[model samples]
Target: MKGSSKTHLRIVFTLGIIVLSIYESSSQFLNDEFCGNKEVLTLDYRKKPWKGKNQFLLDYLKKIDYKDNIDSVRFRIPVKFWIYRNDDGSGGVTDERVKVFMDSLNHFHKLNNTGFRFYIREIESVNKTKRLNLGYFVEAPLQTIFNHTKACVNIYVCDFIKKKANGATYVVRGTYNIVTKSVMLQRNTSSTGLTHEIGHYFGLLHPHRNYKSGKNKQESVSRTRAYKGSLKKGLICERNGDGLADTPAEPRLNFLVDNNCNFSGQALTDNWGDHYQSETNNIMSYPTHYKCRNNFTLSQKSVMLYKASENKYAKYWNTKDSANKIYHFDIHEPDNTVKMASIIKSNEKQNHTFHKIFTTGKKGLATDKTDWLKFELNTENTSNILIKFTPDKIVNDEITITIYDEDNKLIKTINTSKQIASSQIQLKTLKSGWYFIEINKKQSVSKKLYNYSVELIIE
Candidate 1:
């Protein structure tokens, strides 16, 4: 009897391991923000803050705008909101709450008169369970982030970032992972906190970056140049003081504010015993109350712009595709059927593939989903037409490209591959009106985001 019991237990253990392996393959992990239930990030000291911001932008822009004297382009950034659903699987915050969040973030504008802005376009719901729970110390680092982090900044909102044995809740007010280019905020976080966290995302460090030692009521503080919090004064400027000269070096800001919202300085000193200046109007400065935080010093704004221009995931800002991505929800969806395609000119290439299409169709395999694109060439001169179709990402060599005429008739069909995805396919147009193009999977088995670029060349 004892031997039989042991055998049964071993079999059960093996089965459990197999089940866990299967579970791990499907679920992904994102990093943590707070302790137990505190509503704030633990805080990262800003090193070399705004180190190369101003000069890099000036040099890079000059090459295109004036130095090279070439074409100029506007810069923009995209932020993806990942909302954590309730543990029981109910959706997270209401649409109104999401709107308020966006409005709070949009308060900051692009500097340098550039048409740069942060587009809060895509919102995804992450299921809450032990496998992907928010309260646990899950460490989903950069490689995992890059694999799933599309070409946009990702901000996740959740509950109970950290937990306590007691009934207390450590709400993560807000956090940003510089390496991963991701941000996190508690569901109830204020707009002011949201703005500050994103400023960190844009490389704007706190005026008192990394100065955690000493008590607030000290009435005065000092550190040597060798100290981690030391700022050196020089004939040129104080570079170590938060990486910008406009904001004065402070041992730290006095969070206390009177009714008039003024900086009640404590007259702190640096390592060299120089009396530190007080800063109150800067968003990068720490504020005990969110209302006390209002503006970024001019230098801070310039650095944010530079970071926005150079973020790896932020390509949508400076491109024409941004037009379709303006609203939180867009009406200009990709039409899947042959007849309902949007009309475009020969020179106008339609590149709509980032967001999901509400509508889809089945053309080749019953399971295959289809995307439709249409264009018109109304010239009497039937110039040699070339259609170039590029898929958003690679599929299992199972895509079928179909062309249809103005009267909604199928003209030609071809299978696509990596090398030949952009073949010189001709469209048989009897009249100078609209022609439809359909791209889909051979079988109902393609996960490539229904994002593709189709262009017509009138040679």
Candidate 2:
């Protein structure tokens, strides 16, 4: 405690991020949808011309000789789940179902080693009968009601979706809506359904472009036909459906794929007369059974990464930036006792400061929702200790800070509520000794975790 205010103290701790293995799952379903379809287009994909943007991205991509180690860079995407149920709250998807779906979703993405990781920022429930069923007609009303923050990928899951589509992703043009940023799905949608929809949200086009109209133009089964650096050589597969050179061209697999997940229909050919040996397990395909729709080609992965990297999609990446800017710990941790409180000591510097990002709520099997730390005061001449907690916009959780002397005698307590960001405790004529500080949330939201940050400075 001697040189508390005069010491320079620096606390450095890096969060250990462990990537988990995604679980494998297969479920059966009949139909699916992507934003390219006019029915699900929020601002009308035709008016927005996001496809042209995709073409531009593809053209730029073709110029680069890019190769990745897969593990070198992992982009974090934040997601928010909106679960809708009947007015009685009787028919919505459960948290367990969400966990399962997320597991399989991550699994499909990891299969391609896409380096894109989706993490849940929040899960909210809506008990409105009108929103229990999803369709384009109702999309506007839903959006208005929620007034989506567009802060992250918004996924709305309802009891039922319109026919012929298990899920729909809005495709906006010119970066306005970035419509592909939002997704809507049926409550019972298969893992493949969600995966397919999310693929569209990230700018993936169905291999069988415009197939529902029965006027599908065949993509040439050649990856090198358009390497001349000319967009006018447009009929080349590189300039055709889905624009990536790696995916083999094929007709819609609705009835062409059979029970064993194999192509069972007549052999198809491209405009250039090449045979179409289409992949049955492509994640962006319209396989008869959702079970057969499984993975993305490497080229598809690249396109998604490109789309997500754009400035318009900065919100998703900003979550990762915020995490890096502050120190984060496990939601179930910081289990400190009075005897084991984190210690802070200052030597020769005028002030010592530490910043921490943490979570608080009734969760896990850990101790109550509280954070504990201790600091020593060498010579108590009016001590200034500042404790500040950045408020959670969604939760707005109240917090109480208490200080205790070495003998566990109560010294001072400050209780803050509703949008309060910081609190301070000033003691005059204090004695030199170790004091314990405990921070706790006044109320908790059931099953939902809230993020909190604290900056502690002693002078």
Best-performing candidate as measured by TM-score: 2
Q: Candidate 2: give the clashing pairs.
A: 1-378, 6-347, 6-348, 6-349, 7-347, 7-348, 7-349, 8-349, 170-179, 172-179
Task: Identify the runs in model 1 with alpha carbons over 4 angstroms from their true place.
Answer: 1-73, 110-115, 129-147, 163-170, 212-238, 251-254, 313-315, 319-459
Off by over 4 Å in 2: 1-69, 138-147, 163-180, 211-217, 224-231, 313-459
TM-score of each: 0.50, 0.55
Write down the lDDT that model 2 would get: 0.55
**Candidate 1 C-alpha error for residue 430, in Å:** 47
Compose the digit string of candidate 1's lDDT tens values, residues 88-152.
Answer: 87857654566566655555442223334454445677765442335422332221242344566
Listed per candidate, the RMSD to the true structure in angstroms reads 13.6, 17.6
lDDT of 1 at 308: 68
lDDT of 1 at 345: 66
